[model samples]
Target chain A: MYKKILLATDGSKHSIRSAEHAIYLADSFDSVIELVYVVGGEKSKEDVLHSVDKYEVKREREEKLRPIQEQLENAGLQYNSHLLHGEPGPTIVKFANENAFDLVVVGSRGLNNLQTMILGSVSHKVAKRVSCPVLIVK
Target chain B: MKLQNLKQDWFGNIKGDILSGIVVALALIPEAIAFSIIAGVDPMVGLYASFSIAVIIAFVGGRPGMISGATGAMALLMVTLVADYGLQYLFAATILTGVIQILFGVFKLASVMKFVPRSVMVGFVNALAILIFTSQLQHFEGEGWIMYGLVALTLAIIYILPKFTKAVPSTLVAIIVVTAIAIFGNIGVRTVGDLGELSQQLPVFLIPSIPFNLETLMIIFPYSLALAIVGLLESLLTANIVDDMTDTESNKNKESRGQGIANVVTGFFGGMAGCAMIGQSVINVKSGGRGRLSALVAGTFLMFLIMVLGGVVAQIPMAALAGVMIMVSISTFDWSSLRNLHKLPKTDAAVMLITVITVVATHDLSKGVLAGVLISAIFFAAKISKVKVNEIVALEGKKKVYKVHGQIFFASVNDLLDKFNFNDKVKEVEIDLSNSHLWDDSAIGALDKIEMKFEQNGIKVTYSGLNEESKHLKKRIGGLSKASGH
Candidate 1:
């Protein structure tokens, strides 16, 4: 039923796992995979520059995507990677809504509904407000 | 060094402070009298208490702009004391209550006040408002037309005068106009003088004869305890309000100590009990009261009114005073908080309701707050206990990989530890955080103890998806750092 799957990543280990899962699903269905990464706006310029310089953050993001990209290349699956800057949840939702993706896959930390409402989780917000089905892989 | 800070300069920032003092003085006069009357003491005692406490708090308190004096909560407390023990023993009780507050402050017990739930505060305020309104009903009797006219005039002045001018305090204007008409304009109204004579001298030291006996102490101790709690609550709440309004930090312990000193002094000077007065402090802030000058000026003004213009002050009708108190009561009720409480969890709502009902029915403010705190703690404990742990084993060939689930804490520590079984087939222990989301100090300590015990048994423990807190615990314990490798 699913065709184009957009996977959002914060370059975290969990997001990498989600990316791998999205790639697996896309390869299985012979569907296209779109990879998206977001940098939070509220963070300082120095912090953003530092993250880039450290290579730790970039390595994790590329490491997660590189394997998937290679696999997709081997399987000849249509794929693209894009990076944007803003708040994680809202930016992801807005991107998904505008691009009209069929399925969105994300990861959850398994925080309860009330706590997630307080210390808001991106996956929880996306699942609650998104128009299409959202799979939150914990 | 202290004097240098005090005497730095009055012309620059001090001008604003002086202006604020004048405005606070204007606001405090009516309030002092109104609160004293609520306590069933001579109205002059209220004025005296305000003057004494305000000056003392200004110098000794840690927070600036928190005008400490006779407050509504203390007023409500005094009513029961006055009714049961008469005015003399009420004074004695105030002295004893002051000693208790002093001890609490000395022990630095002010932080304990934070455990008072927000729901309880809302209930206390609403109940106090009802009590203040109820007490004012006495003045509204007999001269129905006059009382109605004064009330209507006060309300009009409060509503209309603020729209035209910011210089004139609407409440002060209401008091002045209503009082003048009641005195000279042939208005058939009951003046303050009809109730009692206004005293002109400064408060004198009066040793209360407490009839030093267990029976007397037993009779008065319960009342004193209630007074201490209400006094502490009101003072701390006022300190918090002043902190927000002024955007300044306060030493809660120091403020409590200052309150204790002020009350003890008030009791010694033959004045009624006092706490931090919220209305006057707000007025002081809005009117440019920035420092100790505002409080000092208010106290000076109150003394001046009593000594020089005693007769003029006496002309203020009881109905007019009642009108002023009704305004104060409405302000203290916290209508927005009451509305928000309805939106909170059912348990919170129930606690809030119980506090309100208990306070109203028993006329005991402390008991209500205590009941609310007790309920809130129980709710918290129950929630903490609900966090469960699961044990899972994945068998591969001849070895079994053990996984532990749930956030471990003191509440769930024993259950989690008990679930672990040492067997010949179990080769590896993986404390899994994939499903476990969080940990507290007790849980970390528990994990450290378990790891030591496992090492003694020659079994190794590895972790997966160890979240931030558990990762910190691993670093602290010098264990292998668990990182999720991409």
Candidate 2:
């Protein structure tokens, strides 16, 4: 039932596990993966959002995506990489909804409870807000 | 554009300005008296200073909608001056302070604004909000739950009523309704009269009798300098916050000049030095005040409160004012700052935290700003100092190419120096720098040293990727000056 799978990662241990599961699902279903990373701040509107300096984000994004990119390459699977910015949870949900992604995947914990308590919990808020099917992996 | 059109642009929001100014003037009375008490001066001095500043800044200020008046930040600095040197010297110092602020404006003190990082700005606003909120809590004391109930009701009316009526501001309506209720019901609580007695007399011109001389100037110089710095900082910062709220730009240097001129006139009128008040400015903006007329009206209304409406003003309950200011503090705070706390760079978050703590602890805006700038600068220097030299031993027609792939500055020169090995088995060495930028003399010096050592070892040295800036600076410093043309 999936076509475009959006894998959202925060480079946490739970996110790495989610990345692996998303990759496996993509392989089995023979679908393209929309590998997305959202750099967060509070500059998010209902739909639109602004970004900070993207160069540094680009560098870190590359490093975070290297392993997943290699696995997809080895499996001969096609994928697209996106580095979006805003409040992380809303940005991800909005991006997925606007792009008509078939399914969404997230880590069970994003930077732990303490960190998310400030910006808010990405996975919990995404589950509450998004329209698409979500798989919150541990 | 025609002059009429220009005038329209300047005074387009006259109605809003007048309404907002009246509300601010009403709000300023108790605050001015309280701050004057803090500075150990007669309450009238604060009232007169606020009046003078409000009127003067209306004419010359950069921010069209901002309100300037006697502020706690200015009062905190004046406590020492008023104590150490008598009121005569305080007046002399206030005049000198104005002159110094005018000099600061002439020198374009606004240029320093570029260095104040975004994190510090948020911290500053947030701290001010906290201070205002907590300060209002004291007024809530002994008034009991009934007072709190009134505060809540007042806050509710201020926020909820705007949806129904847009003619009169909700805040002013709230203030009027709550005060009327408190007085009609004969509530057992503090009123504006308890804050300080406002005289029903006009202020007359009184020049400073500081015996104008070298020794007198010297005695007042330090205090004047401190006042000038603190006042400008408060005014500029308040202006910036208001600009954000109003979504308009301000002329920073012009604001500095206006504040200085206002202070000078205030001193002659027997008022203490003053600056922009953030709390009152927020109240103005929230109440739809949007032009110079608002400031003028605020000042004029203050004089009216003293002479014509003293009885009515005194009857206004402190709880009502407290509720209004409590609303101001709540709205002024940057709630998004807390939400973005975890997402911000740790260094930036640290700087913001430290700034807020310092400002609250020291009660000195200037010191807090300095601490934030200093800490941010040090952290920024440390991060930029991580410029690295990447080695790429690629064979380009029998030559070894070593590429440096980061910014080259004094801090990174040693890294570049330590990475070079002259004994690399090659006929020539091409240092590729298409990705690197040369920032200072030391970097070029390091390159020269590398070339010299390589040439001595019988290997030819050449640069492959000198960007325009690198090439220009290199040529200017003789690194490539004698070698080639741009």
Candidate 3:
């Protein structure tokens, strides 16, 4: 029943699969997909103070999203892209709460299951704390 | 790299360290005697070890608060040594044990500390506490209610002394005040002098004349090995504890080597084997000790106290020392964690209980640890063996998906082999690694076997939903083709 689905991408290997899953679900539900990339505050702050070049980072972020944008367009889905400067999990949850997205999908690197359970993964945190149901693609 | 910068930082840290060392020295005086007696060595040898080891470790050790000296773990190990071989042979064994520890550290084997299970550590600490408590109960007997009163008073003083005063160590104050009152009141209590004559000289280096006796060496070797392991474990653990408290890091290998050196020297100097003392280290940290200077000061203070104040200090009652040990034991027992163990997994609880029971009943720390580790490993193996393989045939297409449900290890290799269908009409076998996570060498070997078998049968096996880690399994099996070119 999701009308607008938000997929968080980190450019990690697993995040690509998460994007694919989000696209497939969006197509099945006839929903609009939003691709959001959150550049961590530590990264953005460093870029802003000229500690590192800004255009270099901006170009890298765009290059990461290019394939996923093309996939969404080829699937004929209503897609929009946004970039935010913040921490990953909390930033995603804040975006979801503010935007009224029906679903959120994320990925995990699947280490020790026991350790993951004790110290929750990012997806597990979103699932536990967020008001909406969050899917964790491992 | 700059000399002035280096000097400024070293001196800056040293000022804070020396203050902490004074408090540590005060606490060490009583503990050194008590721990030495527990090891069945003369009380003075304990003092000698504490002095020498502390000074040496101050210069060579990696962690700031890790005060190396005679500890209860080494004391327990020394019991078997003293019982089997006389003091001379025990000394020889301790020296050799030190050499072994040094080799272990030099070989960079300190990382093996991580292999010690959490449950085993909890069991070891709790069991040692019980052992210490029981040992003190012997001294408390036949001395009337005054003995109990003294112990209670000492504990009370130790507890309240810290709250009112920070200038003097609570334990030292408790001992001194209790000893002075006991002597003046002529309280018929057992004193340290009652044990034996206190040696006034520094521990002299002498060759142990055990005469090349293989039988005696064979008997003491096992005990020495246990001592070495316990010494290594306790020292490393104490170093880590101090590191956490002081917000600093220790080069574990360096610390272990320093411990090895301390023990070897202690043995030569007529002292029993020793290790890093967690209680003293914590006391040092709490008392404002900040660097190597404090440890060196403590060592110096201990040597001076033994040589000049030996007669006066020896007049302190054994019951008072027992009381101190009893307090130390209770503090180290981790009763809250023991109670919380019941809330843990049944296997963990079982391992912990087994370790504690074995350690206390057999009085062997190494056996208890070994028992706990073995049980934990078996429990892990059993859990991994429960994973099974399932095959699903999707009706939507002729897609034949083979799901590896359980872990594929040497133990469960046959199950995986038996589940696969090698007959004709099988288009492609999709090995699902989505639910499978853990892999061991045996499991990888099993996968290799399956790959060889499948290749011989002309069956194509493609892995689906393989996570980054489990993909390593495909590499081991020599059967992975990347799903995407990127």
Candidate 4:
């Protein structure tokens, strides 16, 4: 039985679906979910440049996590949310591996072949690197 | 914990580091030679600087995987120094530049980078690209059609070869193919050898042959200051870029000190001072470099290439180097800046444009950056210098009540005074300053003037909201001219 579930979300539609799967798993097994959101370095750089007020940047990041946190709260599931910095795939992998998560739930990206080859898909990287069972939901 | 961090930073990705290091080393050659020519020194000076700086930085640099080498910005600052006083004086200046950079690191001045607006950063980059592009143009002048044809061929290969295979950097392939064509086809054209002498001899440690006196210090101080500023600016900016690419943070103060050490050693080694190279670092990261080993391999491999293939490298056509440099400039430029200029705030756009124009006009990178920072500061002050005085009409009273808002400083004192109607037939004036903070003596002086004017009109004045600090300041100063009377 999974004791600890790591759920990585970018607040995308695919991630929302993955979060639902995580919620179902946590409900069945009574696993504590560790909800994680990674702020990509590029995005943070853009935030610093665009936001005139520093609080606006913090507000925007929290805004991205509110709905996902609300879903967990409504489910009556025990969970802890974390805000991490770096590229999504590697940071998630590092955190999950360090914390020895029971399983990782991530969303499969919809990028085309060429785009994936160039920019790379974060979920693919996480699946390859993390030392845990990964559930990639579309 | 320390040992683990060292392992992660130094040897975490050995195979990838070595491979990418080779790619970065290959890319470093043309730039090293080109920057040397710009500084009006022998190609060996720049080559040795690149090798020494890279090797030294690998061991001491704050940012792992960031490649440091002879850079165009540093080279441009050295041009007049090398021309006026020759190589010896240039070496002394390089040493001085290193000393200044070390002091900057010790003072933890890297925090000043936060004050630089994003618009200024964009401008600095665009200006650098333009500067590099213009420097390459010198080779194209007075050359025949063969040079143009060779340059075109070089560009084609650099752009097209990666499609077939990326095992080797396209730049290295381009250099090899272009050199082979020029030599085998029996075409006469300018080559790297023509720019300066290249030998298999290694750089040796020696103090520059200059008189140790106050006069010598005076001669090189200006040049050294300029070089120090430009070098640190480029290196720190390049570090930020690499940090973003790798999704990691780097110690900027440590990097500053590392650059100083590298440059100081490079100066003693009969080499020019250098800093982090943006184009080469990008090549390094894109090629999978992720640890300190990559930079180490890059430095060693560059020396190996020069020592083993000195003759062949010397034969590389100037046109090929020109093509490679042109490609670097093009890639270094932020194309989006041009397209989005009209969409940016007018002040921001103007700052960006001015930074680019000043550097292009004066051939001084530091001047352009300084101008940009100054203009942005002015714009910021103008935006915040408004002291709003709004009448509180909702409050039922026969006396006038005005709420003061925004900053009260020298720039806004006139606005603060202008909002009050001095000739109004009011019995009392109540000024509320709870929301506003007084910044300086000028604000207190202005308040005193307003109170005196109201008193002359027989209107009693009352202050409703003087914060503790402002009240202390006002009491200590005792209303400017009224201090003596008190």
Candidate 5:
């Protein structure tokens, strides 16, 4: 039933699992997967400090998405990827809502209640804010 | 198109802007007062400058959500001028600072920010934190146990209350609670009123009471120039930080112009010049500020607080304000820099340390940054000033062929010259530059000297494999022998 699927990945194992779920749904529904990766403020600042060359920072960021891109290409699926900057949860929510994605998929580590209360899980924020149905893979 | 962007900038996130604006306003008070004390001016001067700058910058600034106000860096620059010539001359100097900054924007000097290395930025921020911390120490002099107790209580509320909720800024909570304790409990401590007189009256426009002549310009020009440079540097850097934090781009040239405008207006209002405050901007962003309205609200709310609750603010103990500033200084510092000292390159570490020490010692932020930049440039030049010569014998050791590698610029020309032997026993000397590039007139001069020396030694010198650009430069200088294309 979905024509456009939004998948947010950060190259973690949980996100890899979430990518599989997205691929299966896209295969069945003939959907176009809109892949997104966000660079947070702290992470971006650290990258700038660690890498003296601008191109090195760009290459490092692109390397994070290589595995997912390889997987998407192996499936022979139609997709477009975007690199965005901001807080991960809010950036993804804003993009998905603004672009009117049919569904949103994210991965969660399923932290304990106390930890989530203090640290604020990104998937929790994304699921709550996005207008479309969310698939939170653990 | 313009209207839509303006609407988005001002009204994109109303609830977030209003709430964060109030938070920023609450944080601005102690900072304004402290910076005033540093500059040897009354507390109201800094307050009025903060109010005007924030409100004006909200409208004209290129970066929304960035907070601009009276800052310690700018105040530190004003100390000598205020001490020597009084407040009127300081006001005139502020106006001139604005004009100079506007000219800088017109000339598009913001492009120079790229030359500032990341290490220097880290050092600047750490130095600022140190300065703020040192400024707080003056409040603890000859104080009783009650002052220490109140400060500790303020710190406790600031650090602990945020764990349960962040709906209200913990800094605001700490200030309110501590103020209540100091007033109701009859605790004896130094209040803000004890620092200087604070009137609830609005700032009125007044020309600086000074002669408008060349003598006046001579008096204020140097101070104004220093203030302008420091103010623009701090503001532009803060703009970059905000741009990164919010994942947005800002027009830095426009920000320069906006800062100039704000300072000019603030001067007429009998206030000192100021710039963007990194601590306040970070607080605004973390509190969900995302639009121009946040800064506008911060300015207006500060004025509102002064007018409506001036009496209560006056009764606030200096201990509470010092505690808040200490917290700000702690957060402003880059603690990880210390941890990463071993991981960073030795040159970068040295540059950062030098920048920090220079700033802390001289109380001059711009000079520290400049020193860091100059040192890093020298280090870079030294690193790249290598010109290697590879010698080969093609004619049974009778003819020596030298292959040059690496860039030949002013720094490397001497190294290049030193690599060649004028008394070589060969009949012919061939210098091959296929792998090297000539960058400046110095490289050409070195080539000429090498050829002259070889000729004088009864050896014929010929250059081969000159790239088109270098060949063109050689032809222009007419200094070197012919280069046969290889």
Candidate 6:
């Protein structure tokens, strides 16, 4: 019954594993996967006024998603890639809820400070906050 | 040093700075007097220091718009000196403190402030808040409910006045109205005049009267060291906060030297030493101050009030000032930290609590921060010590890959070394470090131990996917690991 799937990655090994699980789920459900990598720098007004270099961040995101894209293409999975910008946790939740994604597939735990603060483990925030089912893969 | 920055920093926001300066000047009056009492000096001494420091720092300070004045944190450091060596020696110490601070600036010690952790800063803030609140209690001694009622009234005015208009400072209004009530209502409360007499004259320059000997130098040096450190810490932290608020950069080294010069000048002018006040600086900024003229105006206005309008300022009730300072303590405190204590990691919470308790118990700001940093470091070391090294064997036990995870240092090198049992049926081992980082010589030593142990067992140990830093550190440590060949 799933039409759209959101896959969130932060370039960690765990996130890459989560992308693998997302690709598998998209294949079974016949859903188009939306691969998203958000650059988390806009946490406050000060952060917005002095944001991190978006150009460099976009390039880094593409590099991180390369292997995942190759896997999806090999599996004949239809996917749309997105390099979003904002604080990781709130931004991810907002985007998924607004787009009416059928499922959000994320890592069980994130490695970066912003991601850890946003999700903080155990019945993870994405699983708790998102309207759609959140599959937290290890 | 660009002319554009100089003009923009000083005059681009002249009107705002002047208004902010006036508000800061009003706030400084009662605070200077109270801090002077705490420092065991005449009220005018605090005023002189407040004025001189503000004026000099306005022209030469690193922070363009921050308000520097007589502060309780610096005053706390002075109490012991004044009690032991008397005012002359205290003056000598203040000047010495300034000289030392100037040297610190020259040596680029201001950048060292980054080493101070945010937890320590929060702890310091909370401790100062408690100290300020407790210091105000003595003024309430042997008083009736009427004095308390007046304090409550003053607090109401301060809290409420802001909502109606920002044109006038609520603190100034609160002080004026409360003092007017004290005079007309025949309230049995103490005023500034009750604390000490007013001279209302210009500060006369005087050299500190102390013998230029080792004994004198020894006594004053310790006090001077403490003053210089505390003064710079408070000023630099205040500057940082203001920079964040205004989104601007400041010459921190220049600010340090400027505070030194200000204190030296104020010491020569028969005043106690002072530093930047975060509360007043915030008030100045919020009231439209974004330039040097604001600080200059504050100093001139403080002097004008003391010298020309001494009679009126002297009559201002102590209760009103108490209300204003209590508000300052409230604003100065990190209320969010307290609220988020439960959300914080146990280690961070413990550090913040330890800092507050240590500072409160000892009444020493630096000691509390040190205590917090020490405990935080211990906890941090303990946390990183848990990073494990997982070994995965592949290709029918012929190829074994040891995956190192987390940080490697003196504390956790043993953990890395312990993983090489050498009893496994694997003939070759690849130590994959792409997922981890190498930190020090101890880590390099641990790698060598792993290599030797594997060599003894006829298994080839190879490091794979090492980061640049790890590679550099390994090279520096001189062949900590062997090549891929057997």
Best by lDDT: 5
Q: What fraction of the correct interface contacts does each predicted structure contain?
A: 0.00, 0.00, 0.00, 0.08, 0.16, 0.00
Ten contiguous residues minimizing lDDT sum, candidate 2 chain B: B477-486
Question: Chain B alone, model 2: TM-score?
Answer: 0.81
Report lDDT (CA) for all predictions. Answer: 0.73, 0.76, 0.76, 0.86, 0.87, 0.81
TM-score of chain B of 6: 0.90
Better of 2 and 4 by TM-score: 4
Q: Is candidate 1 or candidate 6 better by lDDT?
A: 6
Which runs in model 1 stand beyond 4 Å of their true positions?
A: A1-138, B1-3, B8-12, B391-393, B396-486
Query: Pick by TM-score: which candidate is best?
Result: 5
Model 3 CAPRI rating: incorrect
Instruction: Estimate the TM-score of every prediction.
Output: 0.66, 0.67, 0.70, 0.82, 0.86, 0.74
Better of 3 and 4 by TM-score: 4
The TM-score between candidate 1 and the true structure equals 0.66
Worst 10 residues of 1 chain A by lDDT: A44-53
Tens-place lDDT digits, model 2, residues B170-227 = 7667767887888888877777667666666788898888787899988888678877
lDDT of 6 by residue, B162-280 (tens): 65675777877898899899988887678888887778899999999899999999998877887888788889877866665565778889999999999888889988888998888
Q: Candidate 1's residue-wise lDDT over B357-475, tens digit each?
A: 88888777888888888887887766665544456656563333445556566677766666655543455666666666446666666666656556556667777787776777656
- The CA root-mean-square deviation of candidate 2, after full C-alpha superposition on the true structure, stands at 10.5
DockQ of each: 0.01, 0.03, 0.02, 0.13, 0.22, 0.03
Clashes of each: 1, 1, 6, 0, 0, 1
After superposition, the stretches of candidate 2 with alpha carbons farther than 4 Å from their true spots are A1-138, B9-14, B37-40, B83-90, B133-197, B209-250, B277-289, B311-327, B396-398, B452-459, B476-486
Candidate 5 DockQ category? Answer: incorrect
Q: Write the per-residue lDDT of candidate 3 for residues A1-138, one digit (tens) a residue.
A: 988998888777888889889888998999998898876533432232211223555677788888878878888889999886445666788898899989998887676976664444667657776777787898
Query: Which has the higher lDDT value, candidate number 4 or candidate number 5?
Result: 5
Query: For residues B1-486, what per-residue lDDT tens digits would candidate 4 score against the true structure?
Result: 989989998899999999999989988988898889888999999999999999999988999999999988888878888998999998898888889888889899877767878788788878988998999888989998898998999998988777567788898899899999989998999898988899987889999999999999999998888888878877887787677667678989999999999989999998998999877877787678989999999999999999999999889999999999898888777777788889999999999999999999988888888999999999998988977888864335557888999888888898888899888767888989998988888888888888888988998888978889988887887466554432
Displacement of residue B160 (Cα, Å) in model 3 is 2.3
